[model samples]
Target: MKALAHLNKYLLKYKWYLVLGTVFTIISNLFGILPAQIVRQSLDLVKDTLDVYFAFQGSSLQSGIRDQFYTTIPYFGFLILLMAIMKGVFLFMVRQTIIVMSRHIEFDLKNEIYAKYQELPMRFFKQHNTGDLMARISEDVGKVRMYVGPALMYGINLVVLIVLVISYMLSVSPKLTFYVLLPLPFLSVAIYYVNSVIMKRSEQIQAQLSTLSTDAQETFSGIRVIKTFVQESFFADKFRAGADEFKKRSLKLVKVDSLFYPLVMVLVGLSNVLVIYVGGQEIINGRLTAGNIAEFIIYLNMMTWPVMAIGWTTSQVQRAAASQQRINEFLNEKTEIVSRKKLMTEVKGKLSFRDVRFVYPDSGIVGLDRFNLEVAAGESVAILGTTGSGKSTLANLIVRMYDPEGEIRVDDVPLKDYEVSYIRRQIGYVPQEVFLFSDTIENNVRFGAGELTMEEVEQAVKDADLYDNIQGFPEGFQTRLGERGITLSGGQKQRLSIARAIVRQPKILVLDDSLSAVDTHTENVILNNLSRIMKDKTSVIISHRVSSAKLADKIVVLDEGKIVESGTHESLMNKGGVYFELHEKQLKTEELS
Candidate 1:
C-alpha cells in the first residue's frame, strides 16, 4: 500500500469516480446480504406453517398450509430474485467506474513516465536500457492498476459485508457468533505473513521480467549483427538462461499462492464445522429453533466469502506495492539538464567555446580539455580529428546534450542562460551515426519542419543530392522504409539525414562526419550543394578526409582532446604539420583509386 503513495495525487484528481464506485460497491454488497436474510425468513415461515399443520389436523390444516405455502414462499422467492438483479446492476456500475478510472490513471502514469524520459539528460538513457524502461511503463503500471481497481473494490466490500453480516449473526446468537469468529484473528495473522512473502516474491518476479524483456529486445535489435557474427547459439543460450530464471521466479510465486489460498479455504471450512456442531447441540437442548440454526448457517457462509477474499485482496495489494516502488524510482529521478533562464534576444548564430572541459560519465574519459574556439556568424569551419579527438563531443556540446565546465555561448550570451528548446531548435545537426525512422521519405525529411509544404521537402531532397534516388523508388517520396532505414544503403541513409537537417533551414548547420559513407564523387557534389546553402548560415563540418576540408573558411586540427592547429588548408599544407601529412595521405589514396 505504501508503494502506491506516488499515485495519491492522481487518485485525488479522479476522486469523484472512486467515491461513486465505492458507494456502488457498498450498495451492491448490502443487496448481496439480503439474500441470506431472505433465506432465514423463508425457512422460519416454513417451520411455523409446519407446526400449525401438525397441531391442527384435518381439512382446515391442509387449506391453511396450501395458502401459506403458495402465497408466502413465492413472495420470498421474488424478493431474492429482485435483490440479485439489483446487486448485479450495481456491481456493473462498480466495475465501469472504478476499473475504468484505473485504466485512465494507467494512461496518465505511462505518459508521465514517457515525458520524464523526454526531459532527462542523455546520460540517464546511457545508464538505462530500452526494455527495462518499457517493462516499467507497461507491466509494472498494469500491476498498480490492479491494486487501485479490483483489489481496492473487493477490500472495501469485504469490510462492509463482514460488519453487516456479523451484526446480524450477533442478533441470532452471540455465543455462536463468538465461536464462528474465533478463527478470524489467527486468519489475520496468517494473511499478514503470506502478504510479506508475496511482496518479496512479486518484486523478484518483476525484476526477472525486466531482465527477460531486455534480453529479447537487445537480441532482436541486434539480430543482424548476431547473424553476421554467427553468434545465434550464444544469444540463444543467454535468452534461455534468462527465461529459465523467469520461470523459476514465477513458479515460486505460484507456490506461495498455492499455500496461502488453501490455508484460507480450510480456515473458513473449520468455522462452518464449529457453527454446525455447536448450533446443533443448542437446537437439541431446545434452546434454539430449527429455523434459527438454518439462518445461522446462511450467515456463516456470508462471513466465509469475505474471510477468503482477505487473502486475495491483500496479495494484489502487495504485488501493486512492489510495482509502485519500481515506478517511483523512475519518476523520482532528477532531470539534470533543465533550462533555468529564458533568452530574450534572438539567435544570431555566432558561437564560442572558452576553456571548456568535458568528461564521459561511464568511462571517466576526458572528451575535451581546455578547448577554445570561436566561429563568426555565417562562417564555415571544418574540424579535423582522429577517432576520439573530441570532434563529435564538440558537436554534442552545441546542442547541449551534455553540459561542460567552462562557458559555451551564442551571440555573446552563455548557452546555459538561453532556453534549451531555443538553442536546439535553432541548430540543424546531422550526427556521425545516421538514424532514420521507419516512415515515408517525405516525412523523414520534413520531420522537424512542421507544416512544411511538399515543394520545400523536394527542394531539401534535391539540395542533399538524393532527389534522383528518391525518384527511382517504387512510390517516390511516399516509399516506406524499414527500421532505422535498414532497406537503404549507408550512403543513401546519410544523404537522407542531411536532407532532414537541411529542411529546417536552421541558423546553425552541423555536419558531423556526415559525408564519410559516400564516395568521393557524391561527396564532392553534396559539399558543393552545401556551400551554397551555408553562405548565409554558420556551418560546422567535422570530417576525416582532407578533400572535405579544402573549401572551408578555416580548418582546426584536434589531437588528444586539444586543438593543435587552426588555419586555412593552404596555409596548413605549407607549414607541413599534422594537417599537411593528412592531406598528403588522402591525395595518395585518391591517386590509388
Candidate 2:
C-alpha cells in the first residue's frame, strides 16, 4: 500500500473518472439489490394470496383472487427484469470510466518510465540490463493496471453490495443476519494469511520473469555467437534452467491462488448453511414467515459474489504493490550527470585537457591519469595507442561522455561551464564499437542530423568512401539494414558510422578507432576525404595504425594511460620509439600479405 501510494498523483489526475466510476458502481449495486427485494415481494404476495385462496375454499371470489395473483406476478417479473437491465447498464458505465482510466494511466506510466530511462546517465545503463528495465515498464505496469481496473471496480462493487444487502437483512431479522455473518471473520483471517504469502510469492515470480526475459534477450542478441561456437544446446540448457525456476515460482503462486477461491467459497457456503438452519429454527418457533426466510435467502445470494471477490481483490492489490515497489526503484534513481548551465554556446573546437584524471566508477579502473593535451581550433591530431592505453578515454572526455577530475576547456571556456546538451550537439563522435539501427542506409547516415538532404547524405557517404558500395545495392539508399547493421560487412559498417558523423557537420569530430576494420588502401582514401572535409575543423582521430597517424599534423603515442611520445610522423620515426615500432610491424605485416 505504501508503494501504491505513489499512484495518488495519477489517481488525482483522473479523479473525475474515479468519482464517476464509483457513483456508477453504487448505482449498479443499488439496481442489483433492488431485484432481491422484488423477489421477496413476489414470494410474499404469492404466499399471502395462496393463504387467502385456501381461506376462500372454492367460494365465489376464489377464482377472482387466483386470477388476480396470476396477473400481478408478471408485473413483479417485469420489475425484476427492468432492475437487472439497469444494473447491467450501470456496470457498463463503470467499466467505461474505470477501465478506460486504467488504460490511460498505463500509457502515462509507461511514458514516464521511458522518460526516466532516457534521463538517467550512462553509468545507470551500465549497471542495469535491458530486460530488467523492460520488465518494470511493461510487466510491472500491467500488474498495476489489474489493480486499478478490474480489482478497483470489483472492490467498490463488493463494498457497496455488501452494505446494501446486509442492511436489508438486518432490517428483516437482526438475529438471523448475525448468524449468517458469523463465518465472515474466519474468512477475513484466511485472506490476511493468504495475502501475505501471495505477496511474497508474486514478487519472486516477477523477479524470475525478469531473469528469464534477460536470458532470452541476450541469447537473441548473441545468436550469431552461439551458432559460431556451436553452443546452441548449452544455451538451451541454461535457458531451460531459468524457465524451470520461473515455472516453479509461478506454480507456487498458482497453488496459493487456487486455494483462495475454494476457501472463500467454503466460507460463503458456511454462511448459507447458517442462514438455512437459523431461519428454519426461527420459522419453527413462529417468529419468522416463510416469505421472510425466502427474502433472507435472496439477500444472502446477492451478497455471495461480493464476499467471494474480497480474496481476489486483495490478491490483485498485493501483486500490484509488489510490482509498483519495483517500478519505484528505478523511478527514484537520481542521475549523477546534470547540466550546470543550460544556455546555448557556440563551439569553435579549441580543446584543452589540464591534468585530467578519471576512473571508471563501475570497475574502479583508472581511465585517464594526469592526462594533458591542447589542440588549436583547426588542428587535426591522431592519437596512437595499444589496447587499454586510454586513447578512447580521451575521445570520451572530449564529447563529455564522462567527466574527469581535472579541468577541460573548449574554446577557452571550462567544459562544465557550458551546457552539456549544447556542447554535445556541436561535437560529432564515432565510437570504437559502431552501432547502426535496423533502418535504411540513407536513414542510418542521416541519423545524427535528421534534417540532412539526400544530396548532403550522398556527399557524406562519398566522403567516407561508401557511396559506390551503397549505389551497388538493389535499392541503394532505401535498402533496409538488419539489426545492428549485421547485413553490412564490417568495413561497410565502419564507413557508414563515419558517414553518420560526417553528416552532422559538427565543430569537433572525434573518431575513436572507427577505421580499424577497413583495408589500408580504403583507409587512405577515407583519410584523404576527411583531410579535405576537416580542413578547418578540430579533429581527434584515435587509432593504433601508423598509416592513419602519419598524415596528421600532430601524432600522440600513449602507453599505460600516459602519453609516451608526441611528434610529427617523421620525428617519431627519427626517435625510433613506440610509434616507430608500430609503423615497422604494420609495414612488415602488409609486405608479408
Best by lDDT: 2
| Reference-based lDDT, residue 571, model 1 | 93
Global lDDT scores for all candidate models? 0.89, 0.90
lDDT digits (tens) for residues 1-593 of candidate 2: 99999888999999999999999998988898777778778887988899999999969999999999989999999998999899999999999999999998999999999999987877788888988988899999999999989999888888878888888888889999999889888888888889999999999989998998899999999999999999999999999999999999989988988887898788778888888898999989988877788788777777778778887899899999999999999999997666666657788889898999989888988888898889999898999999999998898888777788999999998888887778888888999999999999999998958687789999999999999999899999999999999999999999999999988999999999999999989999999999998888899999988888866789999887888999899999999988899999999999998
lDDT tens per residue, model 1, 225-328: 99999999999999899999989999998887777668878877888898889989988988777777777777777766677777778888899999989988
| CA RMSD of all predictions | 1.5, 1.5
Cα misplacement distance, residue 95 of candidate 1 (Å) = 0.3
Task: Tell me the deviation in Å of residue 217 in model 1.
Answer: 1.2
What TM-score against the true fold does each predicted structure earn?
0.97, 0.97
Q: Show model 2 residue runs off by greater than 4 Å.
A: 285-287
Candidate 1 ranges with C-alpha deviation above 4 Å:
59-61, 284-287
Q: Distance (Å) between predicted and true CA of 105, model 2?
A: 1.0
